[model samples]
Each structure stands twice: as C-alpha cells, then as structure tokens.
Target: MTAADLPEIKILIDATELFPSSMLGEMVQQFLSGNEAKEIWLVLTNPQSVGVAYVAPEKLTDGTFNLLLIAVHPKQQGKGSGTQLIAEVENRLKELGARILLVETSGLEGFELTRRFYLKNGYELEGRIRDFYQDGDDKVIFRKVLT
Candidate 1:
C-alpha cells in the first residue's frame, strides 16, 4: 500500500478494537518511511481496502518476524479474508528467509476469537505477559515456524 492508502487503512484499523485511531497517522508514517523492520500489506477488494496487516522483521535476530497488527473490516470478518491476508504475509516473510513468525494479542474475553484464529492457522502458544496491557488484560504471544 502507498501513502494514498492510509486513510482507508485507518478506517479498517478503527473498525477493530485492537488499536486507537489517534495512532494511525504515526503508524502509517512509520511504515511509509521505509523502516527496515516494518512492512504493511493491504487487502483490496475492488477500489476499497478491506484488510491491513502490519509486520516487522526482528532486528539482529535469526529469521524472526513479528505480525504486529492485523485487522479485517467488520463486515468481512468471518469470510476467509483474514486468513488469506495472513497467508500472504507468511509467504512474503518466508521468501525473505523468515524462520519464525510471532503474533501477539490481548488476553481478554474480547480477544478470544483473535487468539483462536491464530491457533487455527497453525500458530502455537509461546508465552503470555500478565497484566501487560492494563490491570487485567494480558499479552498472549503465538509463534509459527516456517518450514
């Protein structure tokens, strides 16, 4: 995605409860500026973007990549769009010599589906940080090793 895609990408991000709208601009800027570790991918259906995935390769690590942010439009949530986008990200990361891909999500009731999605997609539970996000919301990390 290009700079012109930021607004739509922000909309997709906003539709989900994962991130705050205020940080969208800064995040987009960071991706656009060619940060060595960061990469953003957009899923477009026609002229409108329906999904976004923000990923980063771990610096000074042995082929590790992080799936930083991923969101699909609310209207398209259960229709395989998210899986397709994730598959694309994994393919690209593998091409870049990534051996392990990690993803983290909130450990709250609201995020159960998100966690399940990762598990369903072949990711294994790696670890969790207690009260990482707040007093109750923990951070659950998942890892997938590329063959």
Candidate 2:
C-alpha cells in the first residue's frame, strides 16, 4: 500500500486495538517508501480497506521472511480474511525462495485468538520473551516452515 493508504489502514488496525494508532502511520510510511523493508501487501474489500500484511527478508538470515504485521478489520474478523491474507503471504514468500516465515505477537488475554490463528495455520511456537510489552504482557514468536 502507498503512504496515502496509511490513514485508512491505521483506522482498520486501530479498530482491532492491537496497536497504537500513533505508531501505525510511521510504520506504514517506512514500508511503503522502502525505507526499512522490501515489500508489503494489502487486502481490500471494494471501497473499504479490510486487511494488510507487511513482510521483509530477514537480516543476516538466509531464506527467512518476517511477517511484520498482519491485521484484519474488526468487523471482518472470523470471515477468513486473515487466513487468506496469510496464505497469500506464504505463497509470495515461497516464490521468493523463503524457507521460513516468522510472526510475533503479544501474550495477553486479548491476543489469544491471534496465537490460536497462527497455530491453526500450521505455525509453531518458536520463542517467547517475558514482559516484553509491559509488566505482564509477553512477546510470543511463531515460526512456519514453508517447505
């Protein structure tokens, strides 16, 4: 997506309340401008923006792609949008010769569905960082072997 799409994308992500609205614009700008990462993908539903996925080759790692961000609008949750987005990403990563795809999320009550989604999609828990987000929130990393 382009930098101009950030405002609407930020709104969709903010609806999930998974990230701070203040930080999304900068992140989107970095990816869109190719200032930090290589590529990003967005899923739109007609006139409205519904989902987004950002991915980049891992630094110092061979054939690894980081699934930087993936979010679907709150209203569109459980409708297979997220699943389809992730599947498309896997296909693209495979085409790029990536052997592994990694995604990280918070270990909080609100993020249980996210963790489950990854697992249901064949990702395994690879690691966890305690109290990464705050005093109680942890960072959980999941890895999927694309081969």
Candidate 3:
C-alpha cells in the first residue's frame, strides 16, 4: 500500500475496538514516511478501511525481519484474514532479504485465540517474556523461518 491508503485505512482502524489510539495515526504517518515496510498488504473492504500488518526490518541475533503487528478487524476475524496477512507479509519480507519472521503476542487469558492463531499460521512457540504485558500478562514470542 501507499500514502493514498492511509486516509482510508484509518477508518478501518477506527471501526475496531482493538485500535482506538491516535498513536496509530501517527505511526501510519511515520510508516508512510519510510519507517516501515517497503510495501504494505491490506484486506481492503473499502477505500480507507482495511485489516493491516505493519512490518519492520530487524537484525535479530540471527538476522531477520519482524512482523511488528498483524491486526485484523473484529468483524473480519476467523475468515483466514490473519493467515493471508502473514503469507503476504512473509512474501514481501522475503523479497526484501528477510530470512525469518518474528512475531510477539500477549498471553492474556482473553487472547488465547490470538495465541492459537499464530500457531495456526506456521509460527512456532519460541519463548516467553514473563510479565511482559503487565502484572498478570506474559508475552509469547513466536517465529517462523522463511524458506
């Protein structure tokens, strides 16, 4: 996606309960200005509405890419959108010299579905960061090595 995509993508973000922050707006602006992936993939349902994945390059100790965020609308969940988004992200990352993709998710009880979704998308359980999310929430880190 390009700069033209942002104004509409903001609408999709607004329709969701998960992303109610104006920081996202700022992030997208920065992303468009070159702080993010060379290309963005979207499950676009309208001009300014979409489910998105914000990718960023990273040099892991092993050197790879990190999919910073893989977000879908609550209304757009359970329709293979997450899997599709991962596939696109991986493909784009590979094209950009990425050899692996690392992702992180919260392990809150309420996010069990989020955890499983990553596993289902071919990410392996790598490790965990205790209390990474808060007093009672740990962060689960997962990774998929691209071929």
Best by TM-score: 1
Residue 100, candidate 3: how far off, in angstroms? 1.4
Model 1, 28-143: lDDT tens digits are 67667777444645555545888888788788998888898888899988999889989999988888888999998899998899999999999999999999999999999999
| Candidate 3 TM-score, true structure as reference | 0.82
Q: Best to worst by TM-score, what's the order?
A: 1, 2, 3
How would you order the candidates by lDDT, starting with the best?
Answer: 2, 1, 3
* After superposition, candidate 3 runs with Cα above 4 Å error: 34-48, 59-62
Task: List, residue by residue over 1-147, the lDDT tens digit for candidate 2.
Answer: 876677788798789776798987666666666776556566565467888888888889989888988989988889999998899999888887889999999999988999999999999999999999899999999999998
| Whole-model lDDT per candidate | 0.84, 0.85, 0.72
Point out where model 2 deviates above 4 Å: 34-37
Model 2: what TM-score?
0.87
**Which pairs clash (backbone N, Cα, C closer than 3 Å) in model 2?**
none
Reference-based lDDT, residue 61, model 3? 43
Provide backbone clash counts, one per model: 0, 0, 2
TM-score, candidate 1, is 0.90
